[model samples]
Target: MRARGLALKPYWSALQSSIVSGDDRMLFPPFGNFLVLPSVSPLYVPEDAKPSQEDLQAARGVIMSEAQAFAAEIRSAFVANLVEAHNGARTLDSPLEDVDKLMRLVTSAVPCPSGAYCSTSATFPAILDHFKVCSSAALTASSVSTSPMRVLAIQRVLAAVNEVEPGKVDAAKTLTAELYALGNEAFHCEACLPQQAAVGPAAWSNAHSTKMGWTKMVHHLLVRHTMLGQTLPTVIYTPLKPPSDSGDAAATAETASGGFVVEDAES
Candidate 1:
């Protein structure tokens, strides 16, 4: 969780910038100033018409809400994976059933080994015998040292009980359910500027607009976010054609001959 927080630092910073400046360019650079329109031509906002304070505040609030919801969804998935991994390690056998069998095995008559218990060499029967003998003596004689074989057997049984206990599963289920509920709340929300903010007064009054403007804006922002997060691929630098001039050709050729420029992968 700490590592996840660290990884999201840049995203948080960008979100904060968007909220503070009332400009989503920090979050969605490419389509921040553009809006979705129904016509073939794109809608552009004029510089003179700034977004209203109400629109700006609403846009920031919506973006923040969507971001938080997205984070919650991711957190829920992470918790679900954790629960699955923990449950996968457990055996299907009931802990109570195992404990009953273990108790009976420890009490039953069995041949005790002469030498000290060696975990690597000792079989299940040998361990039971050692535990039975050591436990019986320890009950009467307080001075008798606890046997490693007895401790090992008890630990194994308790570990099985701890891992497969019904309470833990119930608790995990409750937690997962809560996370899923949170995830559902953000299903329809998206991290993008609202239509009223993205499209200023000029474009907002245009008749070519449709109700799908917000959906398109969200999609555009999503594409920009994905592109910005990706590592830039290495490509050969191709120089553009030089202007047709006798004297400038030599200078342009020399300038264009410069070696490949490596682009930074970080956005």
Candidate 2:
């Protein structure tokens, strides 16, 4: 049995090379985001077990829809950033910091080859491995096979990270679209198997017996409560309105007394 019930084979090669150097090249593969939507591995699925044409098309549709949703969110964020700049306020940095903190929580929850929050090559891989195992185990227990929809949910999370990049303010919108495209390609490739099992123990035990057993075993880990003990602070937004100018206040008082009425400058 693997230590802590977490299997580390899928990332063995990558983890090994980075272990001594403490690099994260293996943990955060080349594509981009890891949590929301990880870069799809072309070698994950085999040619003989490829998903059907119909499934591939369906996956494409789902990925595209997710791309659109991701785009809208990024657009909204961009607008908010612009408004903040115009009004002399800091744009989304505080929120971004909160997100990074949350990410740290997730990354540090598992027993990593390197210490939690340390600068080590194995650190990033540990985080990715943590997510993969947790997510896989969660789905397997419910008898729900990992599908394209799950893929979209994972990809959507990358937006949080993108929003905070030093010079990549617009990265959320752009990367979201790219993720969709990359996802479409990844899912359609021979490596990704189409989801077939329904949720429930019966389906998992009967129809998906072989796959579920292996899948769950490969990704299962018994995490301790201490690993997830941190509490997130609550954020509240209170809108502030600029005070009325002295000239505007005088006009308002005069109008109340029926002495004068304010008019638009153009009018």
Candidate 3:
């Protein structure tokens, strides 16, 4: 059944590659390792069952590392596909739709702390034309959107475009704003901000923080001429820990900074 989804071959291959023993199983795609469903069925523990802080931190590190590896595979493949598309390859009747498919793959490939993931929308015109048309639409959507991941996704795409065609940064911020707006519409919950909502609050906070961080990073790269690194700052999203009494208490509260530090990504 899984093989039928050939586009997901990379993920399946990655999961299979990580398995070192018969005990390895799948809980989720981004998981580094897994036990049988029965072993962790309840998927929660009372306060007494919580692992020590040290153990929890160690586990988070492992999960974060695994998540980075998984995301790297997806990002690399996605970029390659986009570059191929930009190279005047065959037309995707709906290029945005294909981008969404790739985005879905991205979601499954990593444990995005920003909760918003990346912008779910994009449009690619030929390299020579102005990006304004597509970027304007994206910025319009991002204006009311809540997810920083969406904004960051737009930023990364523009950055990639600039890498291929230089001088694209001239209007990329406007593009970023549009992507941010789109994500805001799709994911942000205004009723939940300032800890008022009862759902996915940590994700909300993380998304907000990540968005700000990306905004700064983008400015630094595009305006200040910060050296480009191999990765974007958005890749290192680390969700803040929610209070133990919250509904998310079952979630480990250890620090999620595992990928926050990396070599410069502006290159």
Each model's lDDT: 0.27, 0.26, 0.30
Model 3 weakest 10-residue run by lDDT: 125-134
* Per-residue accuracy of model 3 over 34-85 as CA lDDT, tens digit each: 2111222112232234344454344544553553454344445545545343
Measured against the true structure, the TM-scores of the candidates, in listed sequence, are 0.19, 0.19, 0.24
lDDT of 3 at 94: 49
- After superposition on all C-alphas, the RMSD of every candidate to the true structure, in Å, is 33.9, 27.0, 19.8
Evaluate model 3: give its TM-score. Answer: 0.24
Query: On a 0 to 1 TM-score scale, where does candidate 2 land against the true structure?
Result: 0.19
Off by over 4 Å in 2: 1-49, 89-267
The alpha-carbon deviation from the true structure for residue 110 of candidate 3, after best TM-score superposition, in angstroms, is 17
Task: Using TM-score, give the best candidate's number.
Answer: 3
- Candidate 1: minimum summed lDDT over ten consecutive residues — where? 32-41
Model 3, which residues run further than 4 Å from truth?
A: 1-49, 89-173, 176-267
Q: Which ranking of candidates, highest lDDT first?
A: 3, 1, 2
What is the per-residue lDDT of model 1 for residues 1-267, given as tens digits with 9 covering 90 to 100?
333223333433444455443212222211111121111011113333344445444455555655444334433343343233223423223432332233222211111222223111111222322333232221111111223222222223223223433232221122211112211111121223354347764675334232221112222223343353342211111112222322544333322412111111121
